[model samples]
Every structure is written in structure tokens, then in C-alpha cells.
Target: MRHVKDVTFHLLTHEDAVELLQFERAERAWFEQHIEARPECFYTLQGVAKHIIDCLALNAQRKMHPLIIRQRGVIVGRANLRNIADDHAWVGYRIAQGAGGRGVAQSALKHLLTEARCVYGVTQLEAVVAVDNAASQRVLAKGGFTAQKRLPGYSRVSGAPRDCWIFEYSPALSHGLAANNTLY
Candidate 1:
């Protein structure tokens, strides 16, 4: 677990299934409009239980890091590093509707990056944002991600093809390499 300001970034566990389910159910409609639509099963208790179990298994295999974001002990969002391969991972995040526009996502992402580097030894991170998600793009930029390319028909949102902006973050590129060839 990591704390940033008033927000806490925690690894999701089996015990958190109920809380996660409640949060997801509460934000389902809002999330579906802004992010990719989740499978219908994802909103159920059974599905969340299975999802948590799967996330824990993936973490044990060092293939993914699923996290929950909390503020003052209340679950407010989630962030994850998925599809990890080599030294890179794909970054994804979501903030509750009431929690938007407060720099929460940016701060949580910054903390996640630190854990990614120290714990996972990840050197590069990638994020894909829907072309119309200006807020998410801003958060990525605030967290030091740079847009690399635009992928057309990259994903489906609400069952329709959507364009996406690919962004990348590399510690070696953001922080100049030292004479010892080590990331700062």
C-alpha cells in the first residue's frame, strides 16, 4: 500500500471484493460512457469475487498489478498495470464521478509509478486513452506520459469502434541517464 497526500493506493485483495463491487455498481453507468464497457457479469458479487481472485493470481505471477484508490478510507477509484511483458506494462485508471477534477488520478498515478519502479522494476509504461477523453489525457500528461501515436479503430466503446491515443512513459527518458547508465 502507498499513500499520497490524502489518497491511498492499495493492492486489491479477496477481502475487498464486496467494496469493489459496490463501487463498480455505483459507477457503472458513468464508467461505461467514459471508458470501455465492462462485461455484464463484472457488476455482480460472484464476478467481482472471481475478478479479485484472478487479479491476485496474476500478481503472484508478476503479470499484473491491480490496485484500489482510497481517500480518507473510502474507496474512490482504481488503477492498474496490466499486460506486463519484458520491462513494460500497460497503465489504466478510473476515478469516481464525484472524485473527478481533483488531481486524485494524477497523484495516484505518480505513486503507482514509484511502486512500479521499486517493486516491479518496470522501465517503461504505456497508456491508451480514448481520443475524446481529454481529462484522462491531461492526467497522463501530468504524470509525465507522452503521446506516441494515434491508433484508429483501436478499441470498442459502447459497441462502437473508437480511436485511441497511445502514450508512453520511460524513466530513462524523463530523467536523464547517469554516467553509470542507471535510471535516476
Candidate 2:
């Protein structure tokens, strides 16, 4: 587990299946608008159990870090550092509807950054945001992620292709280093 004060990030476990199912069920409509469509079973306990198992396996393989966000002892969201390779990982996050606008995602992400560097040995992080999700874009920017490019048809949402904005957070770049080893 990792945390920033009261907000905690916990690695996914089988015990979290029930809570995760409830969270996903509650946030289904809200989440579907911004993310790819989930399978019908994703909102059920069986699905969550399978998901936890898969996450644990991925963690053992050092290819993913799947976590849940907790504030005041209540699970509020989920985040992942996946596709780890070459000292980099892809980032993804989702906060419950009632949990938005409270800086929860940002704080959780700050903790995740530390874990990514120290625990996962990842030096770079990347996220893809739906073009219409301005709030998420702001959160990423506030976390020191810079927009890299616009990807056309980057993903499918509700079965339709959607464009997305790619953002990247580089620890070296944050320290003022240029790509060619020059200091800014």
C-alpha cells in the first residue's frame, strides 16, 4: 500500500472483488461515457474475482500494477500502471462520481508516481484521455504530464471509435533535461 496522507492506494487483491464490483456498478453510466465499453460481466462479482486474479498474475510477472484508491477507508477509484516495458508504463485512472473535484485522483497519482519509480523501476509514464474529458486532461497536466499528440480513433467508446489525447510524464524531463542530454 502507498498513500498521500489519508488517501491510500492498495494493490488489487481477491478480497477487493466485492467492493470493486459495487464501485463499478455504481459508476457504470458515468464511466462508460469516457472509456471503452466493458463486457456485460464486468459489473459482477465473478468478473471482479477474475480481474483480481489476472491483476495479481500480472503483478507477479512485473507487467502491471493494478490498484484501488481509498479515502477515509472507503474505496473511491481504481488506477493502473500497465504494459510496463523499457522502464516505462502506461497509466490509467478513474474516480467515482462523488469523488471527483476533490483532488483525489491527483493525490493518488502522486503516490502512484513514487511507487512507479521506486517499486516498479519505471522512469516514464503515459496516459490516454478521451478528447472530451477536459477535467481529466487538467488532472494529468497538474500531475506534470505533457500532451504528446492527438491520436485519431485511438479507442472505442460505446462501440464507436473515439479520438484521444496522449500525455506523457517523464521524470528526466521534469528535471529539465532535454532529449539530447542537454540541460534546459
Model 1's C-alpha root-mean-square deviation from the true structure amounts to 4.0
Worst 10 residues of 2 by lDDT: 175-184
Best by lDDT: 1
What is the TM-score of each predicted model, taking all chains together?
0.90, 0.89
Error of 2 at 126 (Å): 0.7
Candidate 1 Cα outliers beyond 4 Å, as residue runs: 1-5, 176-184
Residue pairs with colliding backbones in model 1 are none
The residue-by-residue lDDT of candidate 2 on 92-141, one tens digit each, is 89999988888888776776777788888887889999899998998777
Error of 1 at 20 (Å): 0.7
Tens-place lDDT per residue, model 1, 36-119, is: 888999889999999999988998999899999998898999999888877899888899999888878877777668767878
